[model samples]
Target: MTLKESSGVDNELNKGDRLDVPFPSICFFDLYTLKVFHVLKLAEGQYITTFALNKDNTNLLVSTADKQLIIYTDPALSLKVVNHMLKLGWEGDGLSPLIN
Candidate 1:
């Protein structure tokens, strides 16, 4: 299980974070302790061919032997509130006409 074929983004990230592409699953792990934090199982017969992380280590792009490219993002780093609805907006009255 070596990543020599990887694009080497993992070499630039924090030493604590890494991914393990075992048969049928991708595992999230702490490289220091070799502890697996999470395991994402792929479709029953799928396996990974290679993977790379973004420059800042917030995104993972995986190439599968099954002819698929899967992208995994770090939610806290990759997500934003693109749009939000204020709970107190529009409906100003506590009572509605339907209540009558």
Candidate 2:
């Protein structure tokens, strides 16, 4: 239920080692089963545009592909329906896009 300690992906990592870091793994603890769960995916991918974690860290909101917002309970699973209302040919910025 708590993160006691963590290590970077690099084997040569040390205290204050200045370098680009990778998330080793995302772990979740189950109170009922009294077990810790984690997943490791070895691959390269595009950068995360935006991410919002719940105040309790029990949920997550991820935004990608210009107009897709996904909600997740576990990092790999979609917890809820993401209703996306998008304009076919819209342009501009922010929540309300200016169409020309």
Candidate 3:
């Protein structure tokens, strides 16, 4: 999986002699599926500096050059869902029948 930046401004900003531009966008790609799953616009024109997954692989942490860190959690991997899957004898190797 990778996060790529797309260029082009969706809007413009003018601040006296300095113009703040909105050009970069963050996109989430699924490596196994070779598909783009999601996209987020960089309103402040900051580039992504770091991207990491939590130890449990349930949380994704994204850091930008503007010093902002965002955390994204998987709802399908929540505690309740895991417990339910466990009750259904899921070994965690394949797709859960309850998923869809």
Task: Provide the TM-score for each candidate, comma-separated.
Answer: 0.51, 0.29, 0.45
**TM-score-sorted candidate list, best first:** 1, 3, 2
Candidate 1 Cα deviation (angstroms), residue 56: 1.3
The segments of candidate 1 whose C-alpha lies over 4 angstroms from its true place after superposition are 1-23, 80-100
lDDT of 1 at 94: 52
Tens-digit lDDT track of model 1 for 42-83: 886567889998787777898988899999885755423111
Order the numbered candidates by lDDT, best leading: 3, 1, 2
The TM-score obtained by model 2 is 0.29
The 0-to-1 C-alpha lDDT of every candidate, in the order given, reads 0.67, 0.48, 0.68
Two-way lDDT contest, 2 vs 3, winner:
3
> Which sections of candidate 3 miss by over 4 Å?
1-23, 79-100
